[model samples]
Target: MSEKPLESFVGVVGKETWWSRIEALEAAAAEGRRCGWAARQRHAIELTIARLLRAPARAPNAAESEIVHLAGLLAASFRGLAAKGKAALHASLHAALSGDGALTPIFHQMRVAERHRRRGFSVSFAGLETGAAFDLAISRNGARAEIVCDVLSAEDGREVSRQAWRQLADRVDPDLHAWLAAHPGRYLLKMTLPQGLRADGGGENASPAHLQARIRTLLAGDARAQQDETAVLRLDPLVLAGTDTSQHGLLAQLRGDFGPEAHLSVTVAGQGVFVMAARAAREDDVGTALRRRLAALSGARLSGAAPGVLAMFLEDTDLAEWRGLRETLRLEGAARGFLAGAEARPVAAVSCATRAELIGLPVPQSAAGGEVRFANPAHPAARSPELAAAIRSAE
Candidate 1:
């Protein structure tokens, strides 16, 4: 806190060293003529460093602290690990910067471990050391608990995937603009995908290309509507009953009508407009997916030698839906249901962390008290003072 945040950060992890590495990755991506995750991540980290340097000479905020935290954590991991352990960590580290993977999963584990360490527990990457399946081992006052930190995307519960929608939108955008230009009329395309619009499909499943072609075909026809086993597509006049006609207003209106589960996009070309709204046949319960992950983790990740903790990091979740889950108690319901199941035998508690929390703002932090915890009172470790920081429930 004494020195400037950026200066202190550079000391923690040599800025030139990492900056050059990221730049090299960026250069490779540029030479390949591809803008992918690696390039994007490199840009993001650069922006973080820039922001930190530009911050006023005051107390550091979430983003500043996060950049520093990542630098220090990564530097330490690189220095401390070796051989198979380092190799395993490298795989994740590479994905953390490249590929279609993300850093949230790795960062979530570190934050959870930090919390335990602050509570006076000796924490280590247990799986890296013992080749165990679980992530971290934390012990306090001789009582140890196994903590498994896992990230689950809300998209996993969707009948429609985000990537599929993105691809579909990209595929149809130019065609829609051309069509809209020729037609010069307000238009809307409503869709129902029983099999779901898939980004990756070689079978009868609805592929983005197939769906895009189908929409084009419908636009070419005078029928303005078509229905089949794969999907139902209808073209109609765009109407916003009482809203403004601007692009922003139209998109907002469509989003409201389609709801959070729907994927909607609007295209405008010289006043000829088109809006596409689509949804899968049924909405998948996000809470159910969380429970499914919990069930899967118990068998695959946990060793069952100690009372285990499941630290759930709900990734790719927006604030609106995040609030909806907690308000409707969907998260609570799913977590409790998992705890009641046989899969929970070795699990002592389930705690949830959100992007907001990981970014340093623990929204609601929950009135249930310290960390959204569901303690398994029946587990022997539940009463252990040492484990209390982790397994004790505010409930």
Candidate 2:
């Protein structure tokens, strides 16, 4: 009996040689097969080729020779295709050879498409130390867009410049409605910080509620322009704001309106709120206590009188101590009480987990007319010794 050359070849290549043996098996399957078998063999070969071609170069111990062999096989499969198939094969080859890193280029091309869809235009406004400037542009095919520049330093100047740029950009692409429709809503709302201004904590100075309010304002404008009847303004305070007492309060309010099990994180300084909660809690489930405290102060008002504040009118010592007494809340956490001041004395005072909670309480009025009073109404200096101890310890 004469030996089969392909079978002999496969025996030499061993099962451990996956790439070489796969080729041998494919060649064997193609020889003297029925029409259906031939088609199945071809399909299997094509899929194997694709899988090999798409394998990332970052894979450990991958051989260059194996990759080249796979690429050659794929090229042979598409050598005589018509224009559409050829174009698709070319794009696939480009994507496969470039590996996962090719996504960046793909994204850039999508961005170009997005720009073109908006009547070939884009704009960026960057705030500078001295002032802010708008760079308007008209996109040219396969080239850098042309820029129309304007700068503004004074508050008045910035507003006028912003308005002018808005008018121009609108004429180019009515409110960039097409562009916005293509991108995620959150991306449009992100506030990009200017260089050097990051030292001010990159909008950390704005409370979560404040940031949400700003986003609501912008989204409202977009909705009005689009005349979107079904466009509902969904403000997610927990996601927008860093984890602080204010964020906690906002989350509580949202939960009250929405429901529990809301998968949200309120952050402070861009750090995860879980860390803040962990630091503040004496146990694993202190988050429940924190949420309850936030819910308790849901209707508290803001005063805007101080750089930071944490005002609460709790009758319970445990609630007051747990919510009202933190040494340093992140700027967002503290800004909740920026305007709150008191005309009457606080019944008690103590530091809590975040400064943002202070905004929920009324400022204490002083009996001495200027001195801040910190006696619990139940204890009032003449009453309870434990209250005095708690007050002394707080001081």
Candidate 3:
């Protein structure tokens, strides 16, 4: 056994071999319940990490990629860390490879790209850094209309989007207010609020009627909040789509306002997903936010799930931020502290710009029938196992 190569052992493993190895190790540890058993498991995990670090620094093919991901998964199971611990481990691996070359920090780059994914006028408020901007686009039968408003203040808070807009009023620059007032009939003020805000009791408080009522009351009771002319600013429910039934309200209002002729599109940035909808004929830009969000989530989910094998997927990755990873990991003779007898972990990850690249990474099947066992359910690739299999079979 000691004379044979590591790849020789791993490469010959059958479908159940990886999981069986993990289960046997775990059962042994549980049966003995001894400190020595736990210690041995830890040592094995450390040894595995060392082997991975010392492995030749070349772009791995599909088989080698499977080995890395499997190795990481097996090591992680041996350590018996919880989900949060696994998350930290996943994060640390990426961090180690971050400064090596042109590699982008996986999470950081996803966030930046996610911020810019929307297709509309991006509005930044004065004084505040341009974080993520809310995108709202309205199209009539005739033309497309867009407006960029700097978010001055959402209820006087620095982070306008995070606060509950119950009794709050956003103080924008006078110019923004003046511009909206000028187009009272066409452009109306719609104060955006964070989603998932629960009431004291927690059910239906975040509903559309409740939110609309709150917005109305806030604007009415505050003498200074009202504009000189318009009574209530138009409510763009597309902006509120994912925030419970509030989106339905927006849809109803949109139908009433636009009738059968005009089209309205709204996209609100949510965590990892974008809430987007279109009425009437759709345009090419409609799916921009959703596509970007999917790509970002897929990259994040894949990296967190399997950091060891993540390096295998970086060959086609853009080198702008990922070059450092290759440089660091490929360094010759550097004392890999954790890789030398000490317990080691995986490194950071790279990103892909498209769904095909993300879903095309090698996946371990649970059965000979080709059922994918180790992908995020939300991943677009996981949605159609047949298609994924066909694609892989072709490759």
Candidate 4:
């Protein structure tokens, strides 16, 4: 018999091994329970072991195997803690793994799922400075999307009294209203109030639909508030067109609206627009407000952008603002690259001009520079002879 290296198990039966490991731990727990350990001790051991065995192997390394062994020891320790009725240790472990204070458990779950397949529904939201927990999730099949919103209190006070909630709602409403107004022919606006958070009787009465309705109503009101704030200013469209394209149009537009001192750039690769204003301008506040507005307009299709940054996909239906902005930037010299789809190869290239800072360091002028060129970099675009000719012409 030969000892098998953990790396050998990397691609072969990875997920199955995790499941088997968890099952073995559970069986051990069952045996311990039958041998006179308390039920709580057995349960604690089961949970700790299950969580630890959840992650798939990232590489075939002895160190990783050692970590798994340590996790097993940790699970056994939990059994002893439970038997001693050490509330503090139990709480600490729970906090370290899952509860409010612990994120390790969630990370472990995500790592395990990644080995099986790409996540389909995972999303992450930024936390409010006001102490609200951000939400991140991986659905049963692993798809992911993240939403960042202000925290609302369900306990005691009036719903409207939550300042953070009101501010969040207000920031989001304008873009929602703009989007609704701009596409009235294709889109419908609907609003509904949710059932009260507190159930009149007992048991959880909040259905998914009810929660969704509440979100809609909050957004509707917020849009109205945004309209009130910007009532005096009219939005004007910005256009960009030319052969020597760049991101100057975007910068120009931002300079015009937010002031010339504002530094604006779009990251084509990441699908994000970043804005930074000069001293004394409250850039963070401006960025937050703008992000909320863009998010509302995009129907939350946009994922989380960094603070003072806004992000949206080029395929969004309500992309007129973004299109107009991107075009202006194109005329101003922003390096742009187009990919066929989310996983497709690049189809077009724009000279890196938008924000030189945001683009990757320029490709070396010669292959001798020790640079590795992308395999099949020309595939998606080369299929179009005219486009391939254009790329060559630019070079």
Clashes of each: 0, 25, 17, 34
lDDT assessment of candidate 4: 0.28
Best by lDDT: 1
Segments of candidate 2 deviating more than 4 angstroms: 1-187, 190-386, 393-395
* TM-scores of all candidate predictions against the true structure: 0.83, 0.16, 0.19, 0.21
Q: Would you list the rank order by TM-score, best first?
A: 1, 4, 3, 2
> Which run of 10 residues does model 3 get worst, by summed lDDT?
149-158
**TM-score for candidate 1:** 0.83
What lDDT does each candidate get? 0.74, 0.28, 0.28, 0.28
Q: Write the per-residue lDDT of candidate 2 for residues 237-331, one digit (tens) a residue.
A: 22434343565575565445433212223222322221110010011123233323332332232121211111222211222223322222321
* RMSD (Å) per prediction: 4.5, 31.7, 24.2, 23.1
Question: Model 3 over residues 342-388: C-alpha lDDT tens digits?
Answer: 11122121112221132223222111221111222232333333223
Model 1 misplaced stretches (Cα beyond 4 Å):
1-61, 77-88, 202-204, 222-225, 362-371
Any runs in candidate 4 off by more than 4 Å, and if so which?
1-86, 95-99, 104-395
- In Å, residue 395's CA in model 3 sits off its true spot by 17
10 residues in a row with least lDDT, candidate 1: 31-40
